[model samples]
Target: MINSSAFQGKKAAYFTLGCKLNFSETSTIGRLLGEMGVVTAAKGEPADICIINTCSVTDMADHKCRQAIHRMVRENKGAFVVVTGCYAQLEPETISRMEGVDLVLGANEKARLIQYLSEAWTDKTDEENGLHRHFSVATKDIKDFAPSCSRGNRTRYFLKVQDGCNYFCTYCTIPYARGFSRNPTIDSLVRQAEQAVAEGGKEIVLTGVNIGDFGVSTGETFVELVKELDKVGGVKRYRISSIEPNLLTDELIDYCASSRAFMPHFHIPLQSGSDAVLKLMHRRYDTALFAHKIRLIKEKMPDAFIGVDVMVGTRGELPEYFEETYRFLESLDVAHLHVFPYSERPGTAALKIPYIVSDREKKLRSKRLLSLSEEKTEAFYARHIGTTAEVLLEKAARGKAMHGFTRNYIRVELPSSQADEALDNQIVTVRLGDFNSDRSALKITL
Candidate 1:
């Protein structure tokens, strides 16, 4: 209901944090505003409106969101500022009171932000509703799927095929913030991907909070979705963002190995290798099942890249438990680890659990896991040296070189002189050479 004239000559800038899902949603919002006649604020330029999409995965994410909001207000004086996404959904009142924040929308209300901007924005007064506005429909009301895709990048697009999570893990607030798991029909998603390819996207990453649990409402499966997506004509590649260990079936792994466009890369969350910690965290799978999943992927696609999400210093994770996780990871063939140190959230089940991990211990464990990740990544890269792989080169130039990722997800960087503008967004077979120490990017020979 916003007057179209209001956005006719205005510019808006967006800042996204957290997952690819957030990026996709932000892009969708930008596209919607563009249709309403608002242009994007160019890089390093100020805009009349600034939208900040936030994440609240941890306490640190909340701190970062506050810092970003404050910085945006200071830099873009008098601009109408909007904050939305997970953090806003969890703490809408707090975000609303922040100086210069014009609107605070939650997960359910965010998609309808344009309408609110039209109706509530101009009517609000300092005496009536204080400085900022807030709206958060209950999480239960956020049932419908909001399809979003990132199209700004020509080489790759992150298509949000699914949203929300049903699994209420002990230490996680994603389920509370995002609501239950849901996704669109396969026909709808296929059409979305086709449109993305028609717009010049070469690859799409299927993203969600819990994609492996796809199709609770539609009676479809993640495997079935991928099979249909594989038949899509224009797109050359698709990558599964991440899947739960218990849900990553052997059938899916086998299919990816022989599929036409699916990449041989898997990011499975194995929050802890210790059985005790896994139980305490309410994870669906144990270390045995996780290891079996890894074995299957490696057996089918030996050169496949596997990433692990591991958390350190969760409640009840004693010294013995920490050692167990570290040793198990060391024994596995995981390419890298996304190591997170646990931080207690207010309403999570972890709050009820005894044996809180000291901050000092958490930092030490996080550091140890990160160091282990470096070793695993280096070894994974070393194993692929002297092999040839198909790489989808990205558009951006980092320093004097351009970077790309192989089908197995090994990052490769080539000199800009060697990679012409025509090479951008094109798939090229390149010989993987030695790892470059200076750049930390794998060298590729044309």
Candidate 2:
């Protein structure tokens, strides 16, 4: 266990769940905690506090959250355990009742966690993990959801210009866990983007629970944010992480296609290809419409990288449904796939349904889709052989040189130029080469 006095200087441990957005927010929070002179302790040893950034996408997420707290207590019996994130935002009371959880912070309260802890911290009651004022957004107003994002790697930062969602899809818990769609003014967002660039961020991913809704100004929309972000200097690329098919507007697609800073990459979620399954899942877009969007993106930029999110094993998905999804993806010109098996979430309409996919069946379906993803990815990589692509050199590799991603999203490792820290953010053109002759990151010719 971490010696109690070791934390007199302030030591912390962090864990996160859910999407890239969660990771981004956790990093932001960790950075804020660092400003107060707290250093992160390795897990298992003891620490001043164990701050858990959680998720509520599924019941499994909540189970893991609860399990983690118990495990933390087992390892460091008297450590202060704090819980926050979407799960806390939805069920602070639930967390408050847990044996090991001392502080349960919701969406808003989590932002000032360190300040709160500093005010109430006491070595005398580490085991008396009490609950905090629940700022859980479960029943709160929608537009009230606060905006936050993450600086995953120094080169790529996720700038959350918006938060919350308006859609009440039957199988989704986001509206309840998060709230309604809320966004920041373009001017405010532009200022933040400028600061991120000035802080050495080479790329900014415009993220949000719902980014398509970014706009507070009259008739303002995400396009305006993209157009303005494209106009910003310093960053070599700006990638739109993901968007709903209906929201990936002609205007937005065209902007990305033409913008010098925007890369030709798009990831759209198509939960299922069968209309029957989609209807049951409450997805707004259908297979036909989803396919059309893919076609349009390919027409504009043949080499543009396209990724699709497919969820298998939903309630209404029959054996035929899996075939339908596979055929749909096979027909697309996408470069890769992110396959997820549908999991039940408490309070979500999905859990009340009678038709359920077995875990074994779900695993089989997931594996089938993932195998196809590898083939599609390999096919995409094969086309790039011998073609020169632009790569942003990040930090070191397994042992030797630096590594980075091409504008199209291919991972490549290049020999170290160790050129000043300037090489950290500057985009370098490299010819695509084969994997290390032995076995390692795919090599590139500078």
Candidate 3:
């Protein structure tokens, strides 16, 4: 048996790379350690433990994770390093062999972090077990569902309603890394949200690998989950993270349009606009269905902000197909476009495709979509200028201007003179002004 007192006064530095889901999970881990008397290390302070959560979304993401692991190890010398997340689950052997890594936990094993840390601490000085590189990974049939609701250094909380994915898209490795689709019961999630409200959380973002497939584990539906959450008092705002186009039902969209706290912002993934490319990628929906969803959201809520995820230069994306994608995106009335240049993930069906987009062509296509995104975003923000909207102010450093987001997800910034710390986390009414000098956010007048 390990004594809990052994963890007293220890400081841990957390490094998370990848999606919001990773951040939420890391925060939960921090809280678990906090219960054992471990506190987060301050900036520029050397930590006794370093927890690194990694991502494997793309090749570039993997590279960044490696760099983060190395930097954390160097900055916090002699810290007991622990790595977990999608990358650690997929590449345990590689990460375990890293110079400073002491323990590598997989997706399922991360829950037993404190137990493993205790064992490591007891056995660190054994010369026979020199440089202990222990790894606990469960890659096949990942069935565990770890519930997480954390507000890590932010005003809005990230509530992970679901985890894992069942969809096996040709260019994706999420299903392999995160296991199958799973979620907690609606009652459990509602309780979690209520707890967040009690803790002064005004906003929450529902995050998951495949949130729309939330009913697989529990017999409940995603709409049911949303309805229950809306009934939670004191939750001023709720935003659904990226969901598949096919799984976004009309009932859900209409309900959000009239719901109490659900925001008028939707993030839908339209990987490709070309039907041929969609088939090649094994996507569930085509451009027609995607366009219909966008239209329905606008018809129900004209002021709704629709953000799309578009991937360029996937396998078999011929020149004409690329043009088709460009034209289809050009026709959409979306508020923003998240453009990504496809990276070839290993062991996927996309590798077997005959045609491949060159790096130069991929860069070109990505540039075109990004430019279109900027144009659409500018137009979306301009339409709201001179209009009145409620903004939820977030905490800012002393003497720094405060920033927040509107109901439709428009970023608004206050003047530096109004950077009062008292206004942090307060929702206030403001008039949207013209774009700031950088055009990144609109200047607001209270």
Q: What lDDT does the true structure give each of the candidates?
A: 0.88, 0.76, 0.91
Residue pairs of candidate 1 with colliding backbone atoms: none
Q: In terms of lDDT, which candidate is stronger, 1 or 2?
A: 1
Q: Which one wins on TM-score?
A: 3
lDDT of 2 by residue, 1-446 (tens): 22234345677777787877777777787776676667777656687677888888776887898887777656665667788888887788877787766777776676566655655566436444443434444446434444455584456888877777777776778777666677778777778778887887878887777777666423588888788878778767888888989889988887788887999888888888888888888878899899888888888877888888888888878899779988988888898888887877667777766788899999999998888988888788778888898888886544567778888888787766543455666788889888655433467877
Q: How close is candidate 1 to the true structure, as a TM-score?
A: 0.96
**lDDT of model 1 at position 204:** 94
Q: List the residue pairs that clash in candidate 3.
A: none
Task: TM-score each candidate.
Answer: 0.96, 0.89, 0.98
After superposition, the stretches of candidate 2 with alpha carbons farther than 4 Å from their true spots are 1-8, 42-45, 73-78, 122-137, 142-145, 149-154, 216-219, 397-401, 415-422, 436-441
- Quote the positional error of residue 107 for candidate 1 in Å: 0.8
lDDT of 3 at 198: 95
How many residue pairs of model 3 clash at the backbone? 0
lDDT of 2: 0.76
- Model 3, 267-323: lDDT tens digits are 999999999999999999999999999999999999999999999999899999989
